[model samples]
Target: MDIIRIEQLEIFAYHGCNEEEKRDGQKFYVDANLYTDVMTPGLSDDLEDTVNYAKACKFINKFLTENRFDLIEAVAEQTTRALLKEFPKITKVDFTINKPNAPIKLPFGNVAVSVSREWHKAYLSIGSNIGDKEGYLNQAVDMLYDDENCKVGAISKFIQTKPYGPVEQDDFLNGCVEIETLYSPQELLKAVNAIEAAANRTREIHWGPRTLDVDIVLYDDEIVADSNLFIPHREMHKREFVLEPLVQIAPYAINPISKKTAEQLLDELRGQSENVNSGCAGCQGCAMRK
Candidate 1:
């Protein structure tokens, strides 16, 4: 990844823990390094293809003057987030805010804070078995696209399947999504839940009928099991509904535990699962029902 460097832009702001530092204000030097695809701008010679350094500088200046903070770390963190929010093209950024005049008892050159952040690619599984099945599924896709931080990529055709557990309900429309997002796993989960809630999903029964159901299948090769969620979902392999749609977008995608591709898992599942396929194409009575 190429970098756009802004070395030591000087600014005088009132950001410090000391009374004098805030009252009289001090010279705070800021350095920002934006990370993204600079090759496009270099080849196309288009300003829009890259982040506008001049505008970024102005943004840093305006944000510092607008907000009041007590520490240089806070200033640096907020600045990084502001830059990312303002410029959609920036994938990652490293920024440092310098306080040259520290009121410490020792003579020092400067005290600064630096931090970095970036986006990650994630895959999600969505299913709905209740009212407006197709509607809930499509709406979830639309909502993911609406988010600025989320880049909704390839989506698979929805396939219908029987209910997974004891709950008796209508068939479900299930599929997978390839998403690029700037949110962490926890943050992304919140966003997906919001989308589900917008579809009027309720968690009344386990593996039950839901207006919309969304699960984070993979987050950049991470393995996690937390209080609210789990990655490489514990039960993905056993469900043909999840596997078929996943195979559509990513046939070679693997299960973190079994170390098998989605296609491989689907093949194994076809032999054991009760109802596998939803009847492919024109098959009058297909056995591969999910």
Candidate 2:
């Protein structure tokens, strides 16, 4: 990735731990590496094709002066997020803040903190089996797009599917969405759960009916199997409801565990279903067997 470097941009801001430091304020130094493609602008000699360093510097200065925090870590984190949000073309940010006037009562050159953040690709499965099913699904999509940290990409058309569990509920409207997000897997899960709560989802039974259901299907080929979350969801390959809509939005997306594409999984599932209906011997080895 091409980078634009800004070194030691000094700013006077009110950020410190003590009452005197907070009240008096001090000068802070910032260094940033803005990652993006500069080849186009270089070749065409057009300022519009690349990030405007002057504007970014001005924004950085203004941001530091406006926000008050006790630690340099907060300054770096908040500044990087704001910079990424303001500059859509920049994919990543490497930020550092320097505090030379820290009150340690001893000789010290400087105290600093650095952080790096970037955007990641993630896929989600959404379903609604109760009232206003389609509307709930659409609203979920809108809410994801509304978040500044997330950029909605491709979305599949909704398809009706029978309930997965033993619950005697109505059919579900299922779909998939592709998005680019700056949030980690845990953070993304929290955001989606908040959206589900807004749609009045209830969790009375396992795999039971819901007003709105959101599951993380994939996240940049990452494999996470914890108590609360799992990526490339546990039962995605076996469920036609998930594979069908997932294939529409991301046909070539591979499952990290099985290393199979969405289309391949769907085809294998359908083939097994056919064999079961035809009373073939392979039914014993079918995905639906157990």
C-alpha displacement of 80 in model 1, angstroms?
Answer: 2.3
Highest TM-score model number: 2
**RMSD (CA, angstroms), candidate 1:** 6.1
Best by lDDT: 2
**What TM-score goes with each of the models?**
0.79, 0.93
How far residue 110's Cα lies from its native spot in candidate 1, in Å, is 2.9
TM-score of 1: 0.79
Model 1: residue 213 alpha-carbon error in angstroms: 1.2
* TM-score between model 2 and native: 0.93
Clashing pairs in 2: none
- Candidate 2 lDDT by residue in tens digits, 1-290: 99999999999999988999889999999999999999999999999999999999999999999999988889998899999989988899999999999888999999999999888899999999999999999999999989998999999999999999777889999999999998899999999999999999999999888999999999998999889999979999889999999999899999999999999999999988888889885744664876
lDDT of 1 at 32: 86
lDDT of 1 by residue, 235-266 (tens): 88888888889899988877777788889998
Angstrom error of the Cα, residue 258, model 2: value is 2.7
